[model samples]
Target: MVSFNKFLASVFLAVAYASSSIAAPRPAHSKFATHRARVVGRGLQVEAFHPPSTFQTFGEGIDHPLSKRTESTMEDSAVAFVGSQLKVDFNTIAVRSGFSGEAAKHVFLRQSHDSIPFANAVANVAFNHDDKVVAFGSSFVTPNSIASSSPAIPLEAAIATAEAALGGKFNQHPATLEYFVKQDGSVALTHVMQIQDGEAGIWFEAFVDAHSGELLSVTDFVAKASYQVLPIQKEMLTQGFEVLTDPQDMTASPAGWHNTGTTSATSTSTTAGNNAIAFKGTQSSVTTQSSNGLNFIFTQDPTQAPTVAANVDAARVNAFYLVNSIHDLTYKYGFTEAAFNFQQNNFGKGGAQNDRVTISVQSSAGIDNADFSTPPDGQSGAMRMFLWDFTSPMRDGALENDIVVHENTHGVTNRMTGGGTGRCLQTTEAGGMGEGWSDAMADWTEHNSSAVPDFVLGAYVENKASGIRTHPYSTNATVNPLRYSSIATLNEVHNIGEVWANMLHNVYAALVAAHGWSATARTDPTGPEGNIVFLHLFIDALALQPCNPTFVNARDAWIQADVNRYGGANKCILWNAFASRGLGVNAANFVDSSAVPAGC
Candidate 1:
């Protein structure tokens, strides 16, 4: 009797456990919890983790195992490697786009559930010459169960909702259903569409919930291209201009600066071309054609203020030249068609086409400031240059090279980071870096030697020697004392950016000290100089970092970029520079630390 009762009790417990397992719902996927979570600006939580090792060597001189098996292409090998890393099937990983560069081949992949895509979840994989995985970064989320694949609301309704939210009209593209990963790590089905309002100076990629028809989020493509004007190395009008003929890099702009299509250059006389179109006040482009090709020179009165009417021709030409120059210069540093650069024709290269930059000189939009509107790939980016009133003779923003370059850098940094989505740098920390990068690029372009000097921005327009920022960028602590801790008290984006730019100034100085400087750094990319390495890492890290990266995440990406490109040759050099700025390995919680990484 005792043995029979014990057996009955055991059977009862087993049945109860089985019943509970069958009745309960499976837990929602929470891989994000396993990663480090930080609440950045705007109460937004981002999860990121740096693996102990970013690079893995399968065997000595051996190709990746996946590549060795069967006749596989580079894309095939990449998808297989990433799928294996994610513990998912390769078929589910979709290859969106990719580009092959001198150093490595980069592939952008997206995770798909059933047939729908994840709007924000993406992974960037790069392979070195040996077909080995050299670098990887991802924000991919695995879904346990999708509430519904079908949308309750129609596409038309979703478009209407997005248009209403943005106060703009749709760009005539079909809305697509995507699995959007919300900030809380929850997945929602959403209809994504693009809306543009040129009059309002706004362009956005808006996402609307599919089931409830609620507006989820919007990524503004229009970044304020604040400050305007164009120059060469000179940041202001005080530095005279040098006339450059056929300035376009043949390798970068194969069709030349004047041609937008495969056909040869045409001969009309406006500042319009494949890379940029310069006009003034609403669609009126200056039409002065010189025998030497689009050359219209004008004289400015040095003693008095200049009028926009008298200098519109020169301003338009300078603006045109500067925009095209930036396009070619950044292209050499890996901002190519495949990287979603601003180009009207891609010439069979990957990425959307028909999106050249539009330059509006003396634009009637506003005064004393400029702006650039960046839509996604295949849409034209617009730049509006305003007149500054700081001087007795108002200054044309279009004549300042630093201001123009600073604005163009907004486009480059926007497209390069987050896999060309143009939405990654929306958070306060990320947005601040955007501004910092613009300032740094401007500072870099003006430097022609290893003897780097403290740089000021908008000095000419502001008519102030101190420039617009609180302090000129300097490596010396006494000169510019901003550090990682400085961001604690900073609430505005530009102020936060001053701290970051100062840190980069230190990093730039350190790199120059370690290697050397290059005089032809602007046009030439094939050098062992510190400036070359700096630009390579600068562009490479943009793709390696996750969307909406913080200061630490960006710093880590730069270090990782060095590891992949230079075999960690500049590890200590980079860490020490960052450490000097209080962003060392031990730094945390916006606090300052002078410690370097253990190995360094």
Candidate 2:
């Protein structure tokens, strides 16, 4: 009787377990607890490990992978971390291959419910060389179970539905298959269609349900352009010119500019029309007025080549070369297809989606100053170097390499920071940083001798010993006393920017002092070992920085970028530079008017 009762009890226990397994969903946290504990053990403090809200301790620097961590092991750990919170089986989170930049040494995971990958990232994790968790960021969310696994409609049908909903004459790109996360926490298969309006400068991402062929969501993919420029032509001529050559010597003739005959224009569909345009091309001449097959000719006097047409031609040719050089230099430092760099050839692979910017070198720009506008990713961007004749300062904004590079860097910063969607540096602090970035690049490009770096902008145009800014940038606080606190009283973007620029100038100086400027600084932008590393770090920091960041946020991103790239070797130098500018470890609570760092 005892044996029979024991057998009955065992049978009852098995039945109860089986029923529970089939009754409801398993808790994701329990499954992920092990991975979470491991991550915590690695010194990465996190309040929660769930998706769409994982907050780690601020100021924690990401380091290089320790020698012990293998690539596969890091990936496995990342997958486990993501999977636990997602409550999904293994292999559900797909790490994007060749994912570098802010996600470098880390895995950028997308919720891969199906074979195809999604457009946006759900989570990312980085492991140090020791295979320890160094950094983790995520926007992941676990979905409630869907009723069906199969789609009722096909991909073609979904594309058609999305197109109809967008309502425009659009030139469609390839459709991307994805799983759309619905508002109700349910998942539906989707086709993400990227389309550009043929009639207007509008680009959008349309998400359509793969099963129902219904439009799931639509969003603008472009942003408005901000206009700013170099002013005046009269007084500019009197200024001691730096790098611009005489117009006669600046012609794009057979003997001039190493003429390559016909070259594809970098302008995008919006700027170049339905078809691509050509520069220095014999096939067609749209902008050039001369029959010499040259857009820029020096028929007029070289010294006094002041005609609007001639000056515009000179500006266009020079601007093209400068911009192209900037592109090539930046590309070498990891600004590739993923970074949304502007390239006409797309570097030979139809290149990931949006990759073009429109430039107006010389136009009836109405203003003396120059400006740039970044419309979304797929759409074309606009940059105009205006022509102005202010007797106070006569200057063709396009003629100055400093001005051109400064303006061009604006495009670079805008595209790099916000995933090429044109949403970056919108806040007061961020905007100031944007201007500072421009100035820093300008100074770096203009630096010829390492003897002493002159912190000046528009020197050729302003013709002043101090340039056009309030003061020449100096590491010495006494010479340029602007600090974060100055932002409060002087809320103007340019004024606030000077303080930021001053900090960067000091940083560059410090890096040069430490790393020794490279002798190849003239031809190569990345030359001067310190400068190259600095530029790379600066560009990488843009990828790491948050949108509309505060001064403190921007500073931290730079510090973290240094940690990621060089394993914090330069952190001390970087800290001193910021500290010198009154932005230090303890500096916080900045008011917009005059925000300064408290101390080192």
Candidate 3:
């Protein structure tokens, strides 16, 4: 069988070079020209814009006695706020989703023209409890006239076109008519639908032109974790399993990992919990009696190659432990219900609940690979871990800590970046950063020192010292030669991700040097230590940055996060770290740059 890396490389290359025949949109006559805008990708699409808040009245009206702070009231207030800022009618703004958290009330809105929603034109607004706006990010476009408000082709034709493009029949969802904004600012009437091919492991949101039977665009939903297992700091078996009681964080998982309610009652007698549920293939769940208090101690035979029949229980328990552990660890770093994290219960926090991670150990879906599928906020994300045959005895990916952490991070980045829409990281650059973030997060969890060490992913499962990538993640220039310019020639997401991950490695080193180290950084969020600071910026920047951000955008968000949290104390350190890796102040369009900020 072909290796996972080779399979992905070929797929990405085909996608990069594929030709498109859709007509481009006309030049945008933006009405919000006076506002600050951030454009990304080759399309020069305005991914985010911040309009002046001089005319905002959300705070004034919210404080009045007549104004009730209900979900409808919040939606109306957000619509009025965005309408006034964007110079559009409030009727044209459709409320997509709204929820209230402890500190803020968030409302997601979509731009509409004549009651037809714009598929990609969206805005996210957050208001503090005092009714003052805290954050606003929008990709809404200026109003433009279209040739028609309805599709020329029938819904059947559109589905057929999508199936033809994917080369398979789809287990399709309901289709809706919407306005699609093209890269060049043109608009097309289209039928948009979510399509899934389970056997092929393909899930995509496809937009088919209604005027003409053409596929305008497709956003992939499957974020492949294509690397190798977790718990005990490193890959499993490398560090023998150790049992610890009550590992769940009270604030994150108040009901504990084994329960889904608000109390600490035992909910299951098997590897099922509030954060994750692990099972083998498509069979019944592996169960244990309550007599042992759910102790899942099983022996691994070192005499021969590993098989599913021999290590099923151990694999399920390890998978369950790793998922719950990562869930709690990340919650401390702000991947909570308010930020759209995975959990079966929200405990009255915000966001759509009833969505915990579903893990399949030793899955029969595929071989030599693992993947995670992220839908919207209320849907459960699925993680499939497969067995690898690279070594003498096959390796269970569920037994690898780095691999599990790597896959789980995909859910975190996807949900956080796009206001929990789970469609922002679809571009080549943005998707590459998703992979890079996964690798960087895995690397961070393994380190507890001031002196940074070289890290490699999937080393245990791949059975190679070099791991699965082209180069080891390192801060040294000679050790990892990848820089911003390296992406100019890189086609595969994993290869492109190396450059981004290495840049983060340098950032970690610089922060640790300036501050201090935290041995307990994984569970501790309070400190001036560099490790804690890195994680704070990492999670905060995901919410601050625009959807489909480039390297520069992500770097800017980190700097902004530091300024917001630390009062700009790490400005120079951050600039110097990014500058060393060719992502300096002057870096643009994947070009190498060495210049830092003028003050730095």
Candidate 4:
């Protein structure tokens, strides 16, 4: 009854139906007949992502939402036609919320519809963005975003597991096992499945809770996936080049925390063993002579401080070099003018020298952790890391150079960018970042030595018997050594350390490849033909980062900002340029966790 052409037309009409938001198959562009045949296929719907609490964007400018480009207003079009240039406001709040320094966006659209369909048209029903979705949680089934992507659990296995176990329940995101050993039995993990729609895929993970044996969380990041190209230049968030000074005569005092041209009053270690340190200022020669390591040194001439100040300029320059080595991406605020002093005599009887660096070598003989943390009213600081003259064997892990470096970074970063969010676990994103930054600097300054910089902290343990060096960096939960912070919890600290060290090494290698040899900046901002290859750019990147910000955004911000100032595509090249030998990173792996999120 139907001709061949009529039958083909009917088939084409039947295949042109639109359906689904995120799971629809993509339309294949081809012959008119083939296009119609593929029109009825599915399309994709994208979902949102929930990352960790630790987030800090690079100091470079970030974006806000509600930009003119996203919203086509009379203002946006007039400028485009009049100026002959498409203008888009990059500072909108909506842009900030919608973007995280990424270069694109993703969406779904109708394939065969020639005209704008009515609000209630069949074609309009495809993008079910507001559709209410169910999520299986620990306690009970809860509501989730419209397009939920979770691994499905087989109902058959769920019944058996619940019957055999006690109270097992499901909580929220990351649907997996949540079991409780109580009077009531719980549920356990069964199995999960994938639910597809169009050209996209959504996989959910299901598990029972402990008490109620309910679904817990889902291990899914997206319900739909596609690419959206971002068209705009990034803005600088924090930009202020440093006032370069001689790395030898002056120090780069970031946030007035380190090498502040002033001596710290507290130098004694909290674990200074049974050693009774005597002060030369208060004790007579008879009493001092009898002591083992007592007469805490003091400047004979207090007012003539610059002499002592310039003496330890090595420490200051070392600090900068140290920090740069650790952070291939960072910023520098430059040196402070305050004078270094050690006149208070908090360590032994006398204080640390008013000008020189000193160490107590034992906690019992010096200031404790609590005292060290108590900063003066207006001053934001913790001399945990830089307050070191590391020598001999370390006691337990209490007073180690590495610990000092890690802790000092916290103080510097806190002062530079108001104190961190103070997240819980020291290994959380923020804490890990802080710890890693410090570890990198310290390891860099300590470079040239045979110390194979690693994630392990405080490897040089003190000989419990002789109170000398008995090297060891490992720490266990049950060690009970008052200073023993669990390595598991501290992995965030050390892993970040290795990552940074590795990054510095990589950048250094790249620098060698790019510049024939190590970068030696003869002057501040580079003297004459010497390019300004200072670590200030990188320091600024790290310093500009918002505490607790995500690593990817931070790294991307650094890259974009560098590219904006330098050339394009060659962004990675500048990363090495900003980090050089004078900055202290003699070599690097470029494996920055920021460069690679999965590594983080």
Best by TM-score: 1
For candidate 1, the TM-score is 0.85
Report how far off residue 189 is in candidate 1 (Å).
Answer: 1.6
lDDT-based ranking: 1, 3, 2, 4
Which 10-residue window of candidate 4 scores lowest in summed lDDT? Answer: 118-127
List per-prediction Cα lDDT, in the order shown.
0.73, 0.53, 0.71, 0.25
Off by over 4 Å in 4: 1-361, 365-377, 384-403, 417-427, 447-492, 516-534, 564-570, 574-600
lDDT of 3 by residue, 1-600 (tens): 233344334434423332122234522212112111222111222222222111121221134221355554767777877887778888889987665643355677788888988777777665656665655667788644564886688888777766655544655556789887654456778888777765566676667678766566666667871001235476547766665666667777777777888555748666787788888755267535324565666655645555545477777777788888889888988888878989888887878888999898877778788888887787778788888988767888887878888898899999887678787776667778888999999888888457788998888787788888888898878989998888777655677678888999899999998898998877778889999999988987777665666787788778766765676789899999999999998987677789997889
lDDT for each residue of candidate 4 in 413-492, tens digit (9 for 90 to 100): 43322111111112133343444455444443333322232333444332222212121211121221211111223323
Candidate 1 weakest lDDT stretch, 10 residues:
27-36
What TM-score would candidate 2 get against the native? 0.60
Query: Which of the two candidates, 3 or 4, achieves a greater lDDT against the reference?
Result: 3
What is candidate 2's lDDT per residue for 54-138, written digit by digit as tens? 4231234333323344545556666876676457766668865323443244454666765655433355555444444545555
Score residue 380 of candidate 2 by CA lDDT. 51
